[model samples]
Target: MSTNPQKVHFIAVGGAVMHNLALALAKKGYQVTGSDDEIYDPAKSRLENAGILPQNIGWDESKITDDLDAVILGMHARKDNPELLKAQEKGIKIYSFPEYVYEQSKEKQRIVIAGSHGKTSITSIILHVLKYYNRNFDYLVGAQIEGFDLMVKLTDDAPTIIIEGDEYLSSALEMKSKFLFYHPHIALFSGIAWDHFNVFPKFEDYVKAFEELAEGMPKAGAIVFDETDNMVDVICEKERADVAKLPYGAHPYEVKDGVSYLITEKGKVPLKIFGEHNMKNLHGAKKVLERLAITEDMFYEAIQTFSGAAKRLEKLGSNAHTQIYRDFAHAPSKVEATTKAGKELQPDRELIACYELHTYSSLNKDFLPHYADKLNAADKAAVFYSPHTLEIKKMPAISAEEIKKAFGREDIEVFTQKEELENYLKAQNWYESNLLLMSSGTFGGSDLNKLTEMVLALPTNKKEKAKPAAKKGSVLGKLFKKKS
Candidate 1:
């Protein structure tokens, strides 16, 4: 917390967020050192360039001598880490990543952006807008945004700190939610739904964590929430009565030519992305900018060029007859919003949508039903998930048949083998149709860009095979009725 360039040692430094924070600190002239049981490329190269990459992976307790100023624990480190134990025995100070974030920005006006979904997008949008307007602010984002170098930063001259607030627990030592440490002067909760079943264990308990985020704010602070999300609505209504509360519902919007238009006081603003959910995201970002005194025109100008974060509705490839997009949409609400958005954006075009059941909740049979009718808007739907993922996560096994049954779509195809799916897609008729790949993880190691390019290059209407390989006895015939 002082000007002294403290000797900070990170327990696990290979994480995307961790590496960025380490870089930010080192750039500020801090003496940063780190250890990771397994440090991969990018992070490895980054640390090495900074003269901080551990000589080898794994905890080096001998390196945790009393001379070290403090130990910043990463969530990836296990509770029994030998270096951690050594640091504890040495009576060295310890801080969770979020705790250190708070210490660095305690004197700034903190705006913590949070929710079950869309936190990264909102944070990125806000950062983009701030930069466009030439406002001075330190910030943090969850994902790798387009124009920013790192996901986190701290600067001395900035009067404000904008953060992507995750509700997950701080490192094992800090049981409180990470956002709780920020004590925001201004905040935004995109929405709340059940997630991190391994942590909260219950829907109500997960909802309660967000409630605590709102309750953590000071009386003079502000909280902006979604008025349409019943869960977020309930939580915000019950939060501390003294905090300045603002409610944001869906924006006044319209869709034309596959672009969404937000009806602003200045004029109707056209957006590259389309959906009711994204309209809500825009409204939430607008309310936050209003708190910082950003006018309607400035917000619109900056947001018009902000083409979402890396994987959120990222365009893979496109041609005259077909287009493909990959999105980080795994939660039930996110799946429904993204699938419906793609379909609505091109009502006349055939929608061939595919999703992977990659998350722990999605792979669980009980959690699969929430996806029922979520993809109904798509003309053709398929669910692809790797059975090995469940084993890797140490959860029960899940089969393709179970997923097909869970989706409740007799026509929805299922695949455990990624190659089988890829081969079928490559040989299929992609003409006059739009494809949407919805998943938080890759489809069984398939190169999304390469596959998308191959599909997009195919002629719109290829010459017909007598029986069309998709005959009743063909590989895909068993999965769907092939209405087309």
Candidate 2:
């Protein structure tokens, strides 16, 4: 809160947003310093370039001096962190990343996008449109979006700040959901699907968090939500009477030659991004932009060039006959929606969907049943999980049979090794086919772009051909195949 150059220290600066925040503060002439036990590329490189990278890898209590203006705690830091203890003993003010962001944008009109899925895409679209119109706004998006150098941006003089409100825990000490602290003046709720099993163990508890978000909005504040979701409808109807409520759904769209076009009053506007869920996200973003006085024409023009947030249906590589996409879709609902979208983009081509069980929720045996039939849209479905990951998480070993049973599909293939999964994919003929890899974590550090190229480089005639179909209800058909 100091007007002059303040000394800010980050406890865990290696995080995606944490490093960005450190760089942003440094750029604003603040004396910024941070420490992290392990720093990954991009974050490490960016922080080092900004000259804010910690001299050592571990926590140093000496860095937490009384002269420091404020200490920003990242979620990755533990309650017993030495620097955190020192800051507490010194009576220095400490704030979680979300709490600090709220403090910086409290005076601005905050626009928050909240949902278990599609929040990143919606936030990306809003930022894209605002940037295109030359609007002066600060933003904190989850993913690295196009045209934005950093994921977190803060300035002294922006009238508006757009935020992607995550429903996860604020910090190790806070335990409160991050979105609850933002106090959004204009909020958009895409939909609530049960996620983050480690935090909200019960489905009702997860839904209640979103309800609290709606209830926290100030009087006269506006809320835009997806009306198609029954849970969202119930929450908005019951808890949002004090605020103005607006509902939106999928915009009218048509896909031509593998390109999706949004049908507007102006005409068919072609889009770089495709998917029914993305179209719905677009509609939600449109409503939010309308509240900001951004015209429909401006929204249409800007959104046509918006590729998408990184790792959200991002096209890795493509050939004339085939295309390869990678998406951050670990939740069951996201997997289903993304798989269906990938299949719909090229309906005539064979769709091969491969998903990795990476997140704590997805790797939990109890939560595996939720994914049943989620990948049914794909012609050939595969699930991959690293046994080492389960060991590291201290979870019990899971069998391929268990995964197959959980999926309720007898034909689904499961792999425990990344190399085997990669080889299996390379063995398939990719001509006139589409491949979608969905996961929150990398498939055990396998290079997706190289694998995509390997598949595209295969000879089409050397691979197995599709089998001919038989007539339904015949005796031979009953013996050969099962009914859908």
For each candidate, what is the lDDT? 0.82, 0.89
Q: Best lDDT goes to which candidate? A: 2
- TM-score result, candidate 2: 0.95
Poorest lDDT segment (10 consecutive residues) of candidate 1: 466-475
What is candidate 1's lDDT per residue for 225-271, written digit by digit as tens? 99888888887877575788899988899888778888877788888
Measured by C-alpha RMSD in angstroms, how accurate is candidate 1?
Answer: 5.2
What stretches of model 2 exceed 4 Å from their correct place? 1-3, 239-242, 462-484
Q: Against the true structure, whose TM-score is highest? A: 2
Candidate 2 lDDT by residue in tens digits, 320-351: 87899999999988999999999889988889
